[model samples]
Target: MAKLFGNLELVLIVGLVAALAIIGAFASSVVVDANSILRWLHLFFGVLWIGLLYYFNFVQVPTMPAIPAEQKGAVTGFIAPKALFYFRWAALLTVVTGLGIAQVNGYLHTAMSFTGEGAVNLIGTGMWIALVMAFNVWFIIWPNQKKALGIVETTPEQKAAAGPRAMIASRLNTLLSLPMLYCMVSANLG
Candidate 1:
């Protein structure tokens, strides 16, 4: 039991299989179905991603320059990497779950359309913005971060490029978040 629990991959696989079995059984017994569960996962992962995002933007980044140079590597090499692992994965999951929710709720097409009533158009704009942000996360940000963190080797020029790429996209996400959040919150109000 100890050995089984010790391997993270194994634990995750077991947990995932158990969760699927439970969900399968529950869905078979219930009428409402599993969309709610997907939505719940979306919300859970979104909160985790955005919460860490704000932490990095609003807290960690600002504090970094203040730390002594000798100690900086500890934060950057160790702590920051771990945080970023979760951050990127959370962001990925957030996007996946969010799209799942939209699809489950039958809003994917309309939200992508940018047509229909005022509220729908508004929601669509937000959806588009979120989609762009997610794309940036998956494409621009994650790839750059790998180089920036030495997760992948690169030239100084490439490393330099990574910083700006990641920063700009993150800032763009920050900018989009304000309006995106508003549209999402107001989505059901109408």
Candidate 2:
């Protein structure tokens, strides 16, 4: 069991197999289809993206000042780069899977245009917000973070500028997450 759990890839594979088994056993009782699968993927990616966002905001950023000057390198050089890689990709995947779900459900246009019913409009609003957040993740946050973390070569002045830019963008995403989540959950309640 320890060996099985020790490898993340192995654990994920086993978990997927277990999920498949459970889904197979309950196939008759549940609606399993393209939209459902896309939604599951979207949820997974969304959780990863948002979880990391929250971790950065609530934990890492707040604790950074308290970290020793020498030890700051551990986070900036190693942990941050890794976390940002997952964060950016997860943000992209979450948007893609979400859009896929909207397309599969035949509401892509309606939702995107905010034209159909109340639920559609709500979801559309959420989609727009998420798109903005994803945009920030890719365009603003990641680029700035690369410089800030010293992944990209830059002067000390530029590096100092980059850190605050990334933080502001990340904080913007965090702020938007609240209303986006409300729209998503409320729209799906029916």
Candidate 1, after superposition: displacement of residue 129 in Å?
Answer: 1.2
Candidate 2 lDDT over 102-182, as tens digits, reads 888888899999789899999999999999999999999999999999898999999999999999999999999999999
The local lDDT score (0 to 100) that residue 142 gets in candidate 2 is: 98
Q: After TM-score superposition, what is the CA distance of residue 118 in candidate 1 from its true location, in Å?
A: 3.1
lDDT of 2 at 146: 94
By summed lDDT, which 10 consecutive residues of candidate 1 come out lowest? 31-40
Number of backbone collisions per candidate, in order? Answer: 0, 0
TM-score, one value per model: 0.77, 0.97
Q: Give the lDDT of residue 187 in candidate 2.
A: 91
lDDT of 2: 0.94
Best by lDDT: 2
lDDT of 1: 0.78
